[model samples]
Target: MPRLRYIEESEKTPQARAMIESAHKTGAPDPRVVSIMTRSEIGSAWVELWNKVLYEGVLPHKLKEMCRIQISVAHQCGYCSTVRSNVAKAEGLTEAMIEDLFRYETSPHFTPREKAALRYANLFKQGEQAIDKDEVYRDLAKHFTDEEIIELGQLCAQTDGVGKFVKSLNVISWEEACEINPKLTEARAEAAE
Candidate 1:
């Protein structure tokens, strides 16, 4: 059970209702969004900002989704890991790639550029200083333009902040959480042969 009650559509404020509807249009409504909706005042602003950050950015949305999933896994945030993984799939990432994400350094599926970004994400998850290291920035610069690096950094930070918040709250139970798509997992396994 969620630590916070999931807000019902009928009881939602107009703002919350709109957000919920938007999420529905995207397919299944995320339970985390519903949990956030319980706090109408904060949730409304958060939802708007979240949408902007995730959807409107210089970096490709697919890369951002991948970064989010990487951060989620590093943080041990089950909710974020599950949701972002699914979003990654919708954005065209292969299941084998996602399954091999943790092994990016050696995974044949990831390109050098992606490996750089994921490495940055891992350092970001480690804390501020890890990202601040000159070596990290140098490595990033080799693959990403300065602007792209900034975008990736911001995405990693935002994902870490939000993912930790949701994970800390214990809003959604393990059973209620979105599981990695079984079909994708099967595909990944078969492809490894």
Candidate 2:
């Protein structure tokens, strides 16, 4: 059960309702949005920002989704990891790629650019001090343009903060949200053997 009441469809403000409907049309509505909807103003703003961050960006959406999953994994946020992993799959990331996320440095699925971005996300998750270092930006620039690096950095930062915030609330587990993808499940099982 969620830590707070989820606002019913009927009880949702028009803006919140529209956002929820949009998300539902895209497939599954994010459970965090539903839980946050109890506070319509905050929920509306949150939905809008989340949409912009995940969707409206110069970077390819697939890369953003991958970065999100990596940040969630680095944070050990089960809910965020599950949701973003599914999103990454939907964006055409293979199950093997998702399973190999922690092994990106040696994973055949990722490009040099992707490995750099993933490394940046992991470093960012370590703390502000880690990300603030000049060496990190220099290394990231070898594969990414300044604009691309900034966009990726923002995505990583947002995922880290939002993932932790939702985890702290304990509103929903990945299991409760039904966010697990069958492909990932199968890959995980295979990797275990």
* Candidate 2 segments whose C-alpha is farther than 4 A from its true place: 27-29, 35-38, 84-90, 174-193
* Segments in model 1 whose C-alpha atoms lie over 4 Å from true places: 27-31, 85-87, 174-193
- Local accuracy of candidate 2 as per-residue lDDT tens digits, 47-161: 6777777777787777777777766655555566566434545678775676787677888899888888878877887789988988998898898888888788778877888
Error of 2 at 87 (Å): 6.4
- Tell me the lDDT of candidate 1: 0.68
lDDT of 1 by residue, 75-165 (tens): 6555665664345457788757777777778888877888898888878877898887899989998998998887887788778987777
- Give per-model CA RMSD: 4.8, 4.1
- Number of clashes in every candidate structure? 0, 0
**Candidate number with greatest TM-score:** 2
TM-score of each: 0.80, 0.81
List the global CA lDDT of all models.
0.68, 0.68
